[model samples]
Target: MLSLLIRGRFPSPAVADVGAGTGLLTRELAARGFAGTAIEPNDVMREEGIRRSDLNFPFRWLNGSGEATGLADQSADWLLMGNAFHWTDIENSLQEFRRVLRPDGFFTPIWVMLDTDRDATVQSVDRLLADAIPSFSRHSDVVMKFINSLSTGTSDFSNHRVFLDSHHSEVMSKERYLNMWRSRNDLQSALNPREWEAVIKKIDELLVEEKVVLKLRTYAWIFEPEEIPH
Candidate 1:
């Protein structure tokens, strides 16, 4: 996935990872030989990201957000919103991104989620979520919105899309799986304290395996603003 997004596309890129929670994506970019600053707003999350990363890597975690990045104008080669767009005011964030990006820069937004269409465990969990929480909604809709935002008057960008069917999976213990949900902002936001606990408990009971392999599909789009008349 990184190869497709980076190979022959950028030369020693300067990336601004907006909303870089725990700096996971920033670390990935650093591992790929890309260097830049990771902007995060939440003090706790930023500190957590700083703790998760060190100076050895090619990037540094900073205090910022997509709306007000505190970065010099036109400084980034790429502005990445990896799962960060969901929390942003789309229009304002885009304008800020454009401000930070060079005229030739790219805006890459990546959305990744469980492949419920292909994985029964994830499907079961979704079903459970819907059944347990009356307000629960399919996560796939967010993926669609991520894709559709491009055509919905967001910007005059030449969009590049990753394959919808492209997916990746990870094998983890059931404990790790449950732990993942325990930390997810989406689930926590959607489910109240008791309700979320019940859902997690149900999932815990549902999974019989010590380890589970989950497949995740990624919806990625690369956006380049069109040149305007001088």
Candidate 2:
């Protein structure tokens, strides 16, 4: 989505992936020729990213929060926050973004939601998450609304663009699909043993009945800051 929003083939140089859990999106940027830094608060997740992801470029892993990025002012050309933005202090994060981004820099927040287009597999995954966790209800709507509000605001940004795409991928087995869900923070921490077992069993049953495939709706917006007079 940002690729379209920025009207560019790849991310800008000097990019920062704030709260880059496990470097999923960071790897994508690195692949696209951006030399980026990752600011992650979770030590375990940061280590996992360093160990697991193939980041060939020289990328610094800063121990920091989105609200208080330790990077210098006007030092970055682009800032990216993944699905983890919902967990951040948005007002503070915005200030941090303003501080770090250059005059014409871009700020992008991305959310990848499973596309529930009446596909049995998509519905199965949705049901598994909804039934397995109680806190799911409170987050999805509120966070989406917050993102929408931030995307709409014009006080800070001179130009902005929004992109929503329906994306799909295939997962061979229920276990493979389950592993993806297991990586999510809320689902991993909240689901009790009984709930987790039940969810997995249900997912297995659904896959057996109607082979599970992954479908997702990815939403992103790129914000270009108003150029500051030197």
TM-score to true structure, per model: 0.81, 0.77
Per-residue lDDT of model 2, residues 46-66, tens digit only = 998888755455577888889
Clashes of 1: 0
In candidate 1, what are the lDDT values of residues 34-110, reduced to their tens digit?
Answer: 89889999999888888887658778778888889989999988888787786887668877887888888877778
Name the candidate that leads on TM-score.
1
Which residue pairs does candidate 2 place in steric collision? Answer: none
Give the alpha-carbon lDDT of every model.
0.78, 0.71
Scored by lDDT, model 1 comes in at: 0.78
Instruction: Record all residue pairs in model 1 with backbone atoms less than 3 Å apart, i.e. clashing.
Output: none
In terms of lDDT, which candidate is strongest? 1
Predicted structure 1, TM vs. truth: 0.81
